[model samples]
Target chain A: MNKGGAFFGVGYLLGLFVALVAFWLAMSGLMKPLLLSLGAVSVAITLFLAMRLDVVDKESAPYLRWPVFIGYWFWLMGEIIKANWRVIRACLRADLDINPALVKVKTRCKSDLAKTTFANSITLTPGTVTLSVEGDKLLVHALYEQDAEPGAFDDMDRRTAAAAEGAPA
Target chain B: MEIWEAFLANFHAWRPWAGALLCVLGAVLVVIGTVGVVRFPDFYTRMHAASVTDTSGATSLLLGMGLMSPDLVTVFKLAAIWVFLFLTGPTATHAIANAAHVAGMQPVTGARARGDVGEREGD
Candidate 1:
């Protein structure tokens, strides 16, 4: 479980490049030639070490579908906002309006990346979290029992599965 | 024509206000979450409070900073930090909760967590 998906390939290499570039540009505001060259050299060295480590894989760099994942992120933010409102309202109530329960959520994602994304999304949203993931079953704890209604998570599952490489081409 | 131009300029001036509003909201959320953490009945519920701070508070704060940033590079930096936090926060929370679960700490059932255990465990 500690090991990431071990299928290093061009996709990971590309991911490494994009990530390093983003890191460099984000940190180095000035576009001086010297700074730019130094950043490139740094990025290259980091990529070389990553290659040597053999840890690059679909799981490590699941940003292959950037559009899909970013779209999901925006959508997740909207969901979080809604959930935050709900939790905030609940917080103000005289008696805590909570019904916490642990549930077994079934998932159809085929890959570890998809599963992890789904689980992390659940946790990122307020009032729901993923306790543990084993195979297709995710133990999720929800603040309100109704929050875990049987089919509540299907949309998230389908989206993350589609966002990851698990989607059918 | 001058009035129309001035009115439009005033409308465009909302960017700063929007950013400031977001920052205020983020601070308010963090404060509320801290209150929840103290008031919640158990470890699981307390986790919910912590997560509120993690997701909404952090996201709002970073977004505010990005919106208020003078340059694209600064926005990019804020975005990077937000994404990093988003990736790490929940995983860390899950780790803590999982560890507690493994240690045989069940979520307090019923109205509230028992004070007896709180006294023994130093709350």
Candidate 2:
């Protein structure tokens, strides 16, 4: 569990700082020096609190493979679009043809971060929401029975597992 | 710089149309989802309808407004709002569903249309 700390000294803090700066800039969109320095103070205070809480670790911010995750995000966006189309059509139909069902799925993701990512991805897509997580099993509710089949989430499960297979740092 | 200026002018002309289209799409989605919530038979089922409003409806509406935004700050704020909703909405939904389940509210499945089989089992 403690495998990634050796590589986590400056690189980890630098990454967090950069993400904070980007978020600050995106939020403010102001180029003035006074406001910029104030934002810097806010980021610094946040980082200090996070450090004090011992949350500057891989478990809390396992985005070391963020590049891969971004690619996965684009693919997930396509999935969301497709799912939205299906849900939208169902919503518009006079006779709602949805066959809602709850199905339990088994996952290979071992750590908390991977499990959460998988669950959030499922919920983010339309037509499916993870109701609960129990060990390796996830209780998912689906709008369509066909989508609840065991094979339906194979691609998603595979990709999620791959994305979460990052080094333990 | 002349081509760039021309491109900006064209974009300005088209932005309103695009924004209107997105807002219309969002409104339709929200109305449909509300109808579904009213029409659905059971608690778990209604949640599915609510999620439709939560995800696509909210996203499109925000994107529409972001398009009409006067500055980058507004766009970023809109994005931040969407992100906040996206992160918290499902968790809230899950929490509610979990609470209902704990309170012994069962989902309406096909076989148990008369609602007899599940009541005894969940306890």
Candidate 3:
């Protein structure tokens, strides 16, 4: 059991290292040997700090579930686009016809990552914004009252739970 | 093979125009969102409008720029920016909204619901 835990820890650390390297390379876009070496040093220092801080864990390095995460991002992009249209319409209308309302959304996600993903997704969408998260409940403010009606966020909550927490879809 | 090549050639010709169109649309969305921020009755509703500029407008602009990028490195950089914005933008917006909520900023809903013009604070 101890050996298995060590191996799992190594996997997460490795994943974090790879992610840091990729991010550094993409942002730097330098192929020169000197610059590459500097980038390597930076990545190493970051990795060392992360290890020392004990943050190289499953939640911090979630790329192991990249497939589900990517799917969720795509779905979320679609939702943002749809919600953008609604808010844009409300914006461009001659009449200031908007009934804003605050609603409580209870999430089924158990993990902190899952709950955060759910709340951020709501805030990411244009028509809705998450005000506060308390335990499993999120206080949401919506531009339209109907958009914040009960059960409106059920699908988002479920999908977020599935993607982030690996709960059943 | 000849037809496929012709389509690919046409696609190359159309790419810049498509990118330009997307950029223009994104600019329009941002302007509309600005209007919403100015015209919306309350803080929360205005936040929703600002998010239009954040999410869709920024996305459209970045996607257009990515399409028009001269090389893969630039595209990758744009993708990184897009990811960063998506991650940080909402968090920042939520921070402001949550602060306001915690400070007891009340939303103006009833006046608009009754088909009257909404009132602003100090009005």
lDDT of 1 by residue, B2-113 (tens): 9988877886377668888999999999988888787766678778778889988988888887778887888777887987898899899889877777777666543344
Q: Rank the candidates by TM-score, best first.
A: 3, 1, 2
Q: Residue A83, candidate 1: how far off, in angstroms?
A: 1.4
Where model 2 places Cα greater than 4 Å from the true spot, the runs are A1-3, A6-10, A31-38, A166-169, B1-9, B111-123
Taken over the whole model, the C-alpha lDDT of each candidate is 0.79, 0.79, 0.86
**Among all candidates shown, the one with the greatest TM-score:** 3
| Native A-B contacts reproduced, model 3 | 0.74
Interface RMSD of each: 2.1, 2.7, 1.7
Query: Which lDDT tens digits does candidate 2 get at residues B71-122?
Result: 8788888989997997798778878877776686656664442233322334
* Candidate 1 TM-score restricted to chain A: 0.79
> Weakest 10 consecutive residues, lDDT, candidate 1 chain A?
A1-10
Task: Please give, as one word, the docking class of candidate 2.
Answer: acceptable
TM-score of 2: 0.83
Worst 10 contiguous positions by lDDT, candidate 1 chain B: B114-123
Best candidate, lDDT? 3
RMSD of 2: 4.4
Per-candidate DockQ values are: 0.48, 0.38, 0.68
Model 3 TM-score is: 0.91
For model 1, the superposed segments whose C-alpha errors exceed 4 Å read A1-11, A31-41, A165-169, B1-12, B110-123
